[model samples]
Target: MKKETLFIAFSTQKGGMGKTALTVLMASQLHYTKGYHIGIVDCDYPQHSIGEMRKRDTDLVMKDEYFKLQAYRQFSTLGIKAYPIKECTADKAIDMAEELMQTSDKDFDIIFFDLPGTLNSPGVILTLASMDYVFTPVSADRVVLESTLQYATMLNDNLIVPQKGNLKGLYLFWNMVDGREKTPLYKAYEKVIAELRLNMLKTILPDSKRFRREVSDQRKSVFRSTLLPADKTLLKGSNIEELANEICQTIKLENHGNQ
Candidate 1:
């Protein structure tokens, strides 16, 4: 495992499924709590959701007490930053990514790629294989899950991830999960979970209005207690952050052991 470079590509071959939200949340969590020097290469330029997200984040920090209040009066203390990577050609993307990895600041610990959703995009295949891990966020619906499963299948058919000394699988996780009781949507989610447990992480990000509200106005995750309460129903767990910790620890394990 590359200690400092846990690169994750958040893509689902489908749009409006909370891919941006999950990527931003994971990046923020890594930066704020675990202290990872993180970089987001927003491949979706012109429609740069991640870059605009960073702006919203800075804006939120200026107005809200959600983020850490630095001793300095300026609200520029948050370290999360984003840059727009050019077109989706595999060679160009791979080269740019490698250069960023090597030349990044000493504090940089993780890198995230916000890839465009379409698999037919010029460089998506290479981008998918290049990642050490992947977080594919699918909503609890059939069309969303079907589109996501296809990407997993595509990645599996072509990529060989070197984990430890052996090849391993890519990690997958469900996002925008609605805690419905045995509904059709829930059943659909269950099917994918059974098929990809090895690739899946156990933590679930429940669907919540807070996620939408913050994304619209605040433009960051609602993880910290200052922005959201520990037991906030919007997050919908015993504790709001309880599931988030599950994801970090699960990914930090020695290996997935399935592949």
Candidate 2:
């Protein structure tokens, strides 16, 4: 029998670090390419990017035909069948997770939870405890990596360790990186990562217009667009899809070690 793996939550104590984007990217990957049964729990209420993007991600999807093919033509072929849940407490979130487990997700191989960027949320601790791993996205800035480190400390200090499971560092990756000369922020961050010796992902998403346009103008992807201004001004650089692909590889390789 195939063992059940419930979910993994992507979180960071700070905002503007690409948490939602990565969460959506991973869900897209697991469903479209890897052929895993997947579900997404969008805990970012009111203005949930995951839900908003899901509602409008079709344009971008069409642009990136490869990923689009993975999503296929089905309505919600990504396999995420639930609507966004609004709650702050761990008890509430866990209760929702338990309820979801009773539904059609019995065959699901993975579930992705897109969490809001807040430490005080009621589900923060419970969500962290329930996950197989928490993938934190960090920017190439001293402040962002420092904030990431601080949250790691909080997980160590505040969270009640689950007797039957454990959470481990998945490493921080630099997102929205510009391919120009290293900014002072990058230099400062290097020293901090060296001192803490925190694990960092090998992939770095270069700062590019494609990402900005995809988010800003509601374009589905950098590769797919008809607007001349958006096409010319928005996607002028190397694609970041490759970096997201590495994240997929990391997810597979990491889980491979468990078996």
Best by TM-score: 1
Model 2 stretches astray by more than 4 angstroms:
57-91, 156-165, 183-188, 212-245, 248-259
TM-score, predicted candidate 2 vs. hidden true structure = 0.69
| Candidate 1 lDDT trough over 10 residues, lowest sum | 223-232
Residue 86, model 2: lDDT of 30
Residue range 1-259, candidate 1, lDDT tens digits: 4454566666777888767766666565445444455666777644777666556655765676534353132225543243223233433565766777777544345567788778777876667777766766666676777777777766765565333321245656666666764566555666756775436666566666555555323344444321222223444552226544665565573331111
lDDT of 2 by residue, 23-107 (tens): 6555544454445555667777657665556555556556766546544543354343332233334435556665665676355
Enumerate residue pairs that collide in model 1.
Answer: none
In order, candidate lDDTs are 0.56, 0.57
Hey, what RMSD does candidate 1 come out at? Answer: 6.3
Span of 10 residues, lowest total lDDT, candidate 2: 224-233
Task: Name the runs in model 1 displaced over 4 angstroms.
Answer: 1-4, 59-91, 161-168, 183-198, 215-244, 253-259
